[model samples]
Target: MTAELDTPILDNHLHLDPDHGRGIDAVEDFARAGGTHLLVVNKPSWMLEDVGDDEAVFRAVFETTIDAVERASEVLPGRAWPVLGVHPALISKLTGRGYTPPEARDIMQAGLDVAAEYVADGPALALKSGRPHYDVGDPIWEASNDVMKHAFELGAETGSAVQLHTESGQDFTEVAEWAEERGLPAKRVVKHYSEGRLDGPTASVLADRDELEIAAEEAEPFLMETDFIDDPDRPGAVLGPKTVPRRVEWMREEGYDDAIRTAHVETPAAVYGIDLEATL
Candidate 1:
């Protein structure tokens, strides 16, 4: 199953938000449209909305992520995978900004508990926070390390994959270095789109690293995204499964076979340790 024309390719990184019309059904439709596999992210917006504001909402968001993954596992079996994410900003939202204390510790511990449960489930747990604060380089960042390591440990225990998101290009390299320095057991580190870098530069950065994974989208091969926003007024409002194929062709034209090859979908099955061979 090489990534030839009409071959079933896995979309290694796809956002699955029900609010944005990207979820199991959208994934299935994508698969039917030629995508053989999809890694659906399970970070619900409610995870942010409920924090500090409403404990019930926060719990409900976490529950929704778990339930969504469970349902996806049952539905796709080997096709859909889920990547659970914990945003660092959530802590401030839950505990209030710069207001640390014994109670803050309690709140963080509670958050960690929820994080640990998701990690234990074997889905690819993604740390969606940025550098220094969340970078594995600083000692203060050790907290982030602890969170990632805990997730990695759980992945090691269950033979699942752990994915890390580096929002900055420099931090992306820092993450790869941190993984090497600490001997973290993560198999894949995903470099989310560096805010404003061009595709060529981003590809160059990713190409330099062997341990990191890059998620390529159809239009933006450097930035992996799948959810089609519902705003008809937007210029790219008609994006869909066709986007993947176009990106693949664009990369081919640019002689980016390596980048194209590294691209794979993040599916619930992959997160849960299903051993389906990579089809592309």
Candidate 2:
């Protein structure tokens, strides 16, 4: 059964794939589990279909994400904000299409330029960008960093939060420096899929008991997420849609009410600059 939560319960990073996955059905699961809010991120372009040199093609991906979120808002008691951008994995796809690393990075940056317009136009509240989680050569790695920097710039320019999908086992010191230089606060730079090891950017730690406990103790001002890809083939690959509210219920049972408020209500509101309390 779902917990009767009074405060907001947010999943900071999630995707809703209508074509391949449960789509709005997943959002219903989250709401039934007592989740109140979501940061619905766009899936990688390649996941939807093969993309080429056209930067404007990303608009379809962003619009698809926004459509999912719009449908989700109809089912949710609280709210769902779309977070759009070029996924770092797109670099690999572009390079595979016979583009050099620098060319691929340019394409990714141009896509972020499109995404920034969405944020500026008030549909999206945050941008998503990060390097590949797996190992790559130095040149490709540098190109990815360049793309990340451009995203930070867009965040700063548009006054939007940025959720980064990155490799595991990082302190995010370099990312913090980049945000600082670009005028985006470290608090607004979220490290998605974090493992509670970061010291700078806001950690959107996975919704696991151990990860939450560690982030509570070590990472000040952290958030929680299921990172639910919503892909049917990989059911529960990262985590499921109901994981966040279930974990919040676990925290409530453990009497960590303050942590729940901070992670679910306060931190997200402050980072995304939204009145989440109003959603209730």
Best by TM-score: 2
Measured over all alpha carbons after superposition, the RMSD of each candidate to the real structure, in angstroms, is 7.3, 1.1
lDDT of each: 0.43, 0.88
Cα deviation at 96, candidate 1, in Å, is 3.3
Model 2 poorest ten-residue lDDT run: 48-57
Clashes of each: 16, 0
- In candidate 2, what are the lDDT values of residues 8-101, reduced to their tens digit? 8899999989999999899999999899999999988878755735765788888889889899999998989999988898888888889999
Superposed by TM-score, candidate 1 places the C-alpha of residue 38 at a distance from the truth, in angstroms, of 1.6
Evaluate candidate 2 by giving its C-alpha RMSD to the native, one decimal: 1.1
Q: Give the range where candidate 1 is weakest over 10 consecutive residues by summed lDDT.
A: 203-212
